[model samples]
Target: MSSIDPMWRLTCVYGELRTENRQRMWNTIVDLKNRSNLPWLVVGHFNEVLWQHEHMSETKRPEPQIRVFRDTLESCGLVDLGFTGVPFTFNNNQSGRKNVRVRLDKAVAIDSWRDLFAETEIKHLTTPCSDHSPIGLTLIKETSQPTVRKVRHYEIVWEKAPELEEIIANTWASLEHNGDLASKFYQQKLEDMSRDYFKDLFAADPNITPDEIVDLFETKVTNMMNEQLCAEFSDNEIADTLF
Candidate 1:
């Protein structure tokens, strides 16, 4: 995560030489674009250039392949930010006419980024021993606190019967925390027992909704509570187990 635009994501890709692999790379970018409308930046060694002029002293660049790359960016609503340091980001490092260079490395972003982060800048950096140039992205925006989400947990079905509460507690306390006969193993045993107890609920209806199952569990718990009350159990004892 960055200090600026914490909600946005920056994705980098190392593209392949083969045509099909390169097409897959652009398709991946479009997939990422569909995931969010937030400020996003996709940049890296794309290996394909949009224009013939991007290739220097090489054979005429393939048009159909470049068209796919352009179409992918258009569909994803991404625009090239254009570089600063050099014309060509990659070099074969070969000498004379054999030398091949193309502006394949790039930085692109969604249009909404201009509205949110108005002072963002892209800079190309020199690479010492690599074919591709490194890039620096500066997104200047006001920082806000990150949002936190709360997660909830449910306990085992203790609410079914008042007598079952003390029975389960004593049985659980007697088990070891680790080893073959551990609490975890016994907990799984209890879960299987509960499922077996509720097996008729599933068998009764071929298309029972999750809500219906929960409702059935609640009804069963309530009935158990009433049974405990009739057996002259204390109010506290009747409220023992919860599902």
Candidate 2:
């Protein structure tokens, strides 16, 4: 048993062990405790199950190997972190032919060591080539919050009953002025107005088009001019207005 850090220490034992070898395994655990300091984790395949129920398949005769494993665990003052999902660690893939499964792999830690591994997880993965499904262990680490960037907002406005020639004329007139302030002010105001109008129109009918709005504005102006011309007294003017 060696201390990896001030808080963490690990000891492992591997390989197959029969009933006769149980005493040697227990002796190893006892020696490690007498040799190592506090706050340690003991993990690996212990080839022995504490209970007959730990095996997925039914065993008609209870094995003395299980009793020895349980007693050794109690003697070492270790706590068993239960299997995450399926209890069996090895499978033969033969359902009824030669199905022999067992829980051999395990992780055991002291009481103080539990707090260091607060978010530990164990998962089993399917393996086509091997007899045992791969077991994966995960340790979650705390992370700081991510920084985010701010986004700028923009508004777009459309000109009402604006002829192409008039737009060009106004743009040139603004350019001819001493500063570009007038052009910028007009452009910004138009964009804001267009955005407001489009927002209202979109609320009413989201599919409204720019061309349709322009046509509507032109039609309204033409109708107003026609009405004013009609109100004039000259008969020739009324005729011209009607035409």
Candidate 3:
């Protein structure tokens, strides 16, 4: 395979329903991987889950099953492609609390495949026809130039400093004059101020005491502690934890 393109060894799996047979099948797959160091992907129903979170309600998830499934993957050096779209890929479709939901199906690939296809994306689409959801595996081709996404950043230390708030407010006011984006404005100011302040703080006189450190934080930070910790946390995480 060229540096621009990698090879594919797509192995479709439909693990046996029986425990003993499933173990044998898992061993066989492990053996295949051991023999070939090629970049490969395994997509299908594995009849098992590696974590309790993979199954909703947790009524049917036993420790032994999860243990064995994890062991098999560890031995084979295989991992889930970190799917998007859905938490669980398999559902019984039963209504009420009696319904069962588990991630029985997924696309797992070797570490080399991940390294080769850094832009690979696996999405678990809505389940149709059968209980299992159809998974889409995409390998993004090397483009003329990679798309650099806009990154939003906030400093954890700034949340405790009010100076950060002043910098933001002033930068935001300046944005009206410059007609620049909020993200760009914030990042630029933060990067500049953070470097200057931290460098000076570190270059302080040797006679500086612990109390002076707190004093420096107060002067430089600007009481940004009021920014609300919720702003730093994700909406889902805030809802789950706070509410």
Candidate 4:
């Protein structure tokens, strides 16, 4: 179980139960199902394969255990999300041997809890640390829209312009005095200043070459020691500084 916040308990169990304990364990799970309304996910190495195809080798299938587990899940209104990637989760330790692995790590969720989560992803993560490859399950919360980070783009066209340095120095000084500007404000100001500066310079000389424009801006910005400005500015500061 993993938790990003301290308010909730995310529990996980690995039940390597014998045949006799299966019934008791199932009953206990059912009891737990009735007791909690919070979001809960129960998954791990159950040591029980649900289907014949889950195994890589064609050995005899444990019909009784599979049937019992499936029946219990159905009765409890739980869904087997089935396998996400590789059908099997475990491989026998016999190296280079023709042993088969079966899907042991399973994921199950209640019907009522389905819409609560944005997505449930299950996959096998490489386990160089152990013999068994670890199964990773992730529950992602849904967001209505994609999160966007603010980025400032600047164009400078002035050739050997001393005034450009002063402008940058003044902006930097203002930002330093403000301690930190809001993200939107910083982005807007930075973009506005950059556009205005370039517009004025280009308007003065429409025949300016691209390389000359770049060189002029580079010279002016370097004079202001703006190389580390990107690192110093936060999201908002960057936005404002560019404008």
Among the numbered candidates, top lDDT falls to: 3
- Work out the TM-score per prediction: 0.53, 0.52, 0.54, 0.50
The top-ranked prediction according to TM-score is 3
Clashing pairs in 3: 161-223, 161-224, 162-222, 162-223, 162-224, 163-221, 163-222
Candidates in order have lDDT scores of: 0.73, 0.67, 0.76, 0.65
lDDT tens digits by residue: candidate 2, 31-141: 887786676677777777777876766343266667777877888788887657777777766644246787777777777777777776766545556677656666564
Q: Cα lDDT for residue 83, model 2?
A: 55
- Taking all chains together, the TM-score of candidate 1 against the true structure is 0.53
lDDT of 2: 0.67
Structural RMSD, model 3? 20.0
When summed lDDT is taken over every stretch of 10 residues in candidate 2, the lowest stretch is 152-161
Candidate 4 lDDT, 20-106, residue by residue in tens = 787777787788777877666677777776777776664666778888877877777777765466567777745223567877777
Off by over 4 Å in 2: 1-5, 60-63, 141-243
Q: Between prediction 1 and prediction 2, which has the larger TM-score? A: 1
Tens digit per residue, CA lDDT, model 1, 1-243: 567734777788788888877877877788888888788778788888877888885577888988888899889888888767678887888865578888888888887765666677778776556887777777764477657764323333435535556656666677734456665556665666566657764465656456633543434457778877678656776578441
- After superposition, which runs of candidate 1 have C-alpha atoms over 4 Å from their true positions? 1-6, 141-243
Better candidate by lDDT, 1 or 4: 1
| Candidate 4: Cα lDDT at 51 | 73
